[model samples]
Target: MTKIAITGASGFVGQTLAKKLIETSPDAQLILADVHQPPNPTKSSNVECIAADLTEASACQSLVSRSPDAVYILHGIMSSGSEADLELGLKVNFDSVRNLLDTIRVERPATKVIFTSSCAVFGRAAVKDVASEADIVPYPESSYGTQKLMIEFLINDYSRKGLIDGRVVRLPTIFVRAGAPTAAASSFVSGIVREPLHGQESELPVDPNIGIWLSSPRTLAHNLVHAMNVPADKFGHFRTVLLPGYSATSGEILDALEKVAGKEVRSLVKEKRDENIQRVVLSWPAKYDTSRARGLGFTEDVGLEQTIKDFMEADK
Candidate 1:
């Protein structure tokens, strides 16, 4: 049977996307390539885990040996970590991608690739209201965003050469993120509200007025799946497009938190500004046009309140 391969299979987005693929595409097989195995094994026989360090040359080659029909590249370091650990970021985020793409060129040119990029690619918003798919001139202000945009362009160039079918979906900062937080700079966005609601004190890294492009994990998972299945003929060529998201200020996020968690729990969010975090957050697009994604059948979460409710319900 034809298989689907995914890197960063153990990550928040990767794990969620894997479960979604199993539930939605029962017949399709999945080969998970990550340095770590899935925390919870899939009940489906179609899911197989391949724990390998993608940054290593040999490991990447071994992964491509499976010859999957489609591949999902979801691995990357976060902004803070990338800045702190430049070497590690270069290895995992940059070199790993190059090695994997090289392996794909040699081993499986026919494999289609869906890359999960980020809205961080656009360093500044050109307009006050919304950005669009046409505004792809990446002015990445941080190491992580720069690397992601680099790979996105590489994928586009590879597609131009007819090497493989490549698609890039620029994901917004996902909210109500499940599980424990990792190194992501935007982790604090969810953390401030999520932790406080669970009776834990959380720190705010930026001001309440800091607006960002936001989406729910469920919507993010849907978009990743949609990217893989969208008819090739419908897209014209291998392209990169920013997905739709609700443009919400941090105060708006906290307001929703208060409604769901009550006054006492909501008050636990302690503010401590970090200039580094603020610098990064301020550069990102405050809004996006996203009409293209909507026209193409991609949808957004039902508003911030419902997203918070979904997070609470899922935690139960």
Candidate 2:
């Protein structure tokens, strides 16, 4: 069996990825590390859900003891939450990254570490037609982005030193995220559309003109698996490549919603501009030059219309 260790296994994306892994990768053993234990965890036969806070160095050290062939580090502080709690962000997002890397360096240096990064690492400056894996080295705008960028740099530096095998995949904002809305700045993107589509009211935290990159939950999960299994030589010139996503303006969101849910449900979405949310959303990259990733066998999103369809189907 191919043993894999994953942090944030209880999260929306994490849970979805875990379930899919269980169904598809039959020869894979999953080591699930999370803060709270998964309720009724016995349903999964191949998973070992361990309750441990990632902020603690000892917890991380002990968690990495499974000696898995690969590790998927999906844990990180959300953008809005990180901005709200500086101390927590520093300890969890920044410090935990260093601690986790150190643990792998000491105990499991041979294991490949697959990191889930974000497009938010790109700053306000507009790059070429589409941002490439090479463009992620620019200055980041937020503390959360800065933290991710710092970790990417550390991963690259450590890889060069032959400390560990690190691959960071910059994920686009995933739509139709399951569960309660959290502190992520991009949460509102799903919130505004998902809530209204299910015959409920939702608050649009930003204007309709705001443009951002997005992908479906299924695509996000598949991309994670792809990054883990893709040949190491495919990286070519750049180690970290910005994932390609459907570039949609907020206005396009409404159009897509109307097409999927009819005009009646579309009206349920209310526009209330929150400056804090708008600031973060506006700073993200509008598009990415993922030709390198595509040529290397990475996938692109199924467009915005299909993204809405996926959300609608999941809600049913």
Give the whole-model CA lDDT for all candidates, comma-separated.
Answer: 0.83, 0.80
Give a tens-digit lDDT track for model 2, residues 162-238. Answer: 67778888888888676788889889888878888767898888888878788888888787788788776677544
Evaluated against the true structure, the overall lDDT of model 2 is 0.80
At residue 303, candidate 1 shows an lDDT of 81
Scanning candidate 2 in windows of ten residues, the lowest lDDT window is 37-46
Measured against the true structure, the TM-scores of the candidates, in listed sequence, are 0.95, 0.94
The C-alpha local distance difference test score for the whole of candidate 1 amounts to: 0.83
67 in model 1: Cα distance from truth in Å?
1.6
